[model samples]
Target: MTTSPSLLAAQDLHVAFPGRHGAASARAVDGVELDIGAGEIVALVGESGCGKTTLARALLGLVPPTRGRVVFRGEPLTYSSRALKAYRRRVQLILQDPTGSLNPRHTVYDAVAEGLRIHGYGGDERAAVAEALSRAGLRPPERFLLRYPHELSGGQRQRVVIAGALVLEPELLVADEPVASLDASVRGEILALLLRLRADLGLSALVVTHDLGLAWNIADRVAVMYLGRIVETGAVEQVLTAPRHPYTQALLSVLPEAPGDPVVLTGEPPDPSRIPSGCRFHARCQILAGGEAERVGVADACRSEDPEVLGGGGEAQVACHWARAGITA
Candidate 1:
């Protein structure tokens, strides 16, 4: 979508965990297809337990998919320790909690330099760490070099974690709710920092988030996940501002800035281990439950047929019986 080379992609991916006593496996990531273009930012958004984080793990090769493959720069991941080790150098992760990610005993320099050491970087470690720190917005990197995680504020700790990832010169970053732990003021700063990093470093990213508002602020494109599958995807403006899927519409409607009163969804998402028959979302779909799909003559289909999996292309796509039929009522 950014007219850049495709950097990272997942094709028909699935990651499932076996249940106790041979129960149905928990399909944490099921039949997902997504792509992040070079220098492009794509947000993977969904509520907790919908498998967004699991998908990120699979993409980073932290969790091997039960099926399908992850393609980086056009090559499928081999999952061999040697290949994965090399692959990690080009793709890094930034976790949600900086305090948890950084060792309290280790100074900022050691923390940021850890990746370089692990990767066996041959260049000047100090210079690389300094540049990474500076790039993460910690000015005068020397000032923070010796400071431990306990000495820094929440925002500074986050920058240090970012610096750690940057030290590897990674081409892609899989950031899971990178700003969810920051204060309101600091949140904007971190988001801006990510944007700046993208512009300056030509970095690509698959940002995992539950906040649609954050996606609107920082992403070039969006993939909305539900029940371990992508229900909708497109350019950010198209997907976030004008969502087409009923699940996506419900997600967006609950945002504080949305014009209408929030559409309160009924019941928790069905367990991943036993996903519903037909449309996985049909039992709780507001549109179908509200009689719109029935009026449009697709409610029966919604209850008996699974929608097609999204192809992860640039074109806006929604996996909905009524939507695909152009019969929104």
Candidate 2:
């Protein structure tokens, strides 16, 4: 199969915040690279404070990266007039908390139609609103049009937010922890809705989530991040079932397993600001200093020199010195 053109690309992206106590800034996203093709879903998976949200904001131009480039549809993105307007139309973000994202003052219809109004789609507002609402599974759109966000259930409110994004007819959707705030029962439904939208609309998605289960369930490809850097990335099945990076393996080990399976992680991940030297995971990685060291070939070099992202089988890629040293899932 031929590879589609990337609708969005982020190269060597870095985002930093002013450091406390007058020190240098804390780098939240460090030397990150990502590509979302015309109609592919790439999930950014990691533990909390791994810079997933920071990366998402960078993609939307909501937060500027300290360094690197963000290109959309072959053009460099900027916050200026024409480019900003065009970028806004092509890329939209769906926040985690629907209640907070949606304005309590506006009704559902107004919220969904707001984008159209701002973008000057005056004549087709009604039709567009109805279609967007319908596409988000809010069928019989009239029934919910006049209702407010508080009037809807948690699932319904989230769907309304989806509808608002859909109404813009964006080419790329960056959903940052979209289902994290929903009830467990409703989470599945929202996930199904997003997948369905992808299938029907051929929309590209960048899903930022801490839940590996969610990534496995909906992502076409998975990129695992740790301490602001990508450690592993590959097809969902390959990365989840046979992760190469120690961090990825550790993540999988802790996942709730079937009967008789053991947990993976030995300790908590290190703080981002005070990241470990060389490989950020050297401190917590079992392969680097555990019973598997002989078999895995994790040497002192792995701890002294950071490994570059290397090509793996298929479209997979990993950044670990011992990737080919007999490490397994």
Candidate 3:
């Protein structure tokens, strides 16, 4: 909630993919500014193709930003192989699909020890792996050491994946859809495990998910992304319980068992390469569609002005013409 980034941050970040065959470049992450405080969990929520995953990859230094920069511990992230190699040890990635993340041939012990071996960890490998597995909720860690990926259940495999990251003893975990592949029950278990890990290890996390309910339950703050930018961000309760942006409101409106009829905005988000001139969301905005912006005398601004979100921590903020006009649909 502070004004500065205490851990990892993306400042004016932009990652673009040059199109081929005379096509325009696709700006996957156009201009993102986000921060994660030490030991705090922040959820990046958006629909598919919203650049959430691209942003995560940039934060991990896997993909270098074309325009902006990533910062860690108040220092700008360096992309050199030597710097990245060292950086990866302190920041680990937890992939979405546990089944594909693990090597079927690798034993649990081998999978967990791979990082230690890669980093040339001189300490006791067995003890470290055991401790990591134990911390990841695999009790009596020795019991699963020799088991193969095929031998373990879905939940257990995910725990192994989490153990792989924990083995490195990272300060931050960037998890991309950590529970999306599991069943409802397993999802709850995984969420609970993440919370437990945070409490036990003082670890910070950046969780990329489309589920606002998951964010509401697990994250201290929620950042709502659309297209390639964050449109709203603040404390989870403040944003989820009372979303200010039209996009965030539409996202929450479609949740299961949520009150009122869903706000069905027609058409998908604009292409990243051909982002509109005005508000990128104006084409599909419910407020604009319902004439609320016109009645409030901000329709022109909604159609011509692209307001930047208020970021870099502190109080809740939103980037929308109607909201800025002190109006809500």
**Model number with the top lDDT:** 1
Ranking of models by lDDT: 1, 3, 2
Q: Please identify which of the two predictions, 1 or 3, would achieve the higher lDDT against the true structure.
A: 1
**Model 2 lowest lDDT segment of ten:** 305-314
Expressed as tens digits, the lDDT of each residue in 1-329 for candidate 3 is 54435798889999999988989999999898888998899999999999999999999999999998999998899888899989999999999999999999999999999999999999999999999999999999999999999999899999999999999999999999999999888999999999999998889999999999899889998999998989999889889888889999999999997799999989988888898977888999999999888998989988888887557574688889898888754
Q: Model 3 off-target regions past 4 Å? A: 2-5
What TM-score would candidate 3 get against the native? 0.98
Q: Candidate 1: worst 10 consecutive residues by lDDT?
A: 320-329
Instruction: Tell me model 2's lDDT, rounded to 2 decimals.
Output: 0.83
TM-score of each: 0.98, 0.93, 0.98
lDDT of 2 by residue, 1-329 (tens): 11678788888888988888987777888888887888888899999988888888888998888898898888878878777877888788899999999999999999999999888885778889999999999999999999998899999999999999999999888999999999999999999988998889998898999889999999988989888888888889888887888787767777786233544665776766666777777777777677565465567757777777432122788887677564565
**What ranges in model 1 sit over 4 Å off?**
none
